[model samples]
Target: MNLVALAARCRAEHDYNPLCDAIPYVRFLGISVSEEAGEFISQLAFRPRNIGNPALPALHGGVVGAFLETTAILELVWAQETLMIPKIINITIDYLRPAGPVTTYARGTITKRGRRIANVTVEAWQGDRSRPVAIAHCHFLLELTP
Candidate 1:
């Protein structure tokens, strides 16, 4: 299945985004996307393998980082009409709070998009949207091919 095509269908149908299934890691993490009031929201459900500190029983920081990063990439893809695959330039992540063993959600906003680069901001929250567990700023190199 072509994820770009799936995403387009979802966008037109105003249904769930199935593009996450095209990425193995994202599927392993149980990431899913939904549209809410014209906004796209990403979610990651709690899983045992995602636990980092077994003592704290909190999610691994790397897992959270990947979640945010992947969210940004998908957001960029959804923004454009073409099937462009973005390469990561850099990602800066800030862990604000411990992510407990609970379903976490992420939302990404494209700050800027140029001819070759795109800047995205993503936030991950567990219990409350206002209280984000972590935030990430990512720069991606766009594949501007015909």
Candidate 2:
């Protein structure tokens, strides 16, 4: 489906936020989002395009970083219910282990939120949540809607 149509469907459902689906980079990465109750979950499908090393066939660090950042933004949008997109201030990512060629999952938590800024913690795991492939801490400058 086209981005506009997908976004319209998302709005009609009033569940998952369409901001992630609307972005071209997120779409290129093939990210899928779902919301259960108030919690948000994002998934990255395993694809050859995402592979960085031909030897190990591991996921690129950039892809994982983008996934985590997207997760943070999606979580913030879902929690705040705002139309304005948040500007990322800083992102610190720690690569824990190699991300194999498999479906990866990411979850972000809004640790703190103020008037103009919010801190989010995100973790991406392939096989187990207890052992994350990468973790990221992101600070975003929120734009408030009038």
Candidate 3:
């Protein structure tokens, strides 16, 4: 379905990401949900505050990692279309280049889902979708004791 249709459906169902709802910062960052390969995709764009320091002047590695993880979790949550939260096991990120000062976007795709584990990959980029600034491989364990 198209974005408008997706939004309508989500509105009709009244489904939302609790994680996104919980973090006001995330909402402030302008993270949005969209359709991807007939599934929901979480998107993150760059802001001045998310910009890098004066010394190095590039996006922080930790920020990139967090974006990847959040995107991956959104992928899982989108696939499930439920309220229960999932526990992530491990996430590995590879930085390809320095993400420019412009707004960057993050997207996640799930490759495999098993009884207990799900494999996901996420990409973040700016300007050149041809070359991603970072790519992440994530392994998620659905249920875990707190």
Could you tell me every candidate's TM-score relative to the true structure? 0.90, 0.87, 0.75
Error of 2 at 134 (Å): 0.5
> Tens-digit lDDT track for model 1 on 33-58?
87778677899989999999999999
Tell me model 1's lDDT, rounded to 2 decimals: 0.85
Clashes of 1: 0
lDDT tens digits, residues 27-140, model 3? 766576666456565666666677666465777777778878878877776666223455788989999998766667777788888777889999888787788999999998
Top candidate, metric lDDT? 1
The lDDT of each candidate is 0.85, 0.84, 0.70
Q: How does model 2 fare in lDDT? A: 0.84
- Sorted on lDDT, highest at the top, how do the candidates line up? 1, 2, 3
* Predicted candidate 2 versus true structure: per-residue lDDT over 1-146, tens digit per residue: 65435544666686554656568899899898887675678999999999998799799999999999999987876675344667899999999999999999999999999888899999999888999999999999876753
Q: How displaced is residue 118 in candidate 2, in Å?
A: 0.4
Superposed Cα deviation of residue 59, candidate 1 (Å): 0.4
- True lDDT of residue 23, candidate 1: 78
Which residue runs of candidate 3 sit more than 4 Å off their true CA positions? Answer: 1-19, 36-39, 81-83, 144-146
Task: Give the number of the best model, judged by TM-score.
Answer: 1
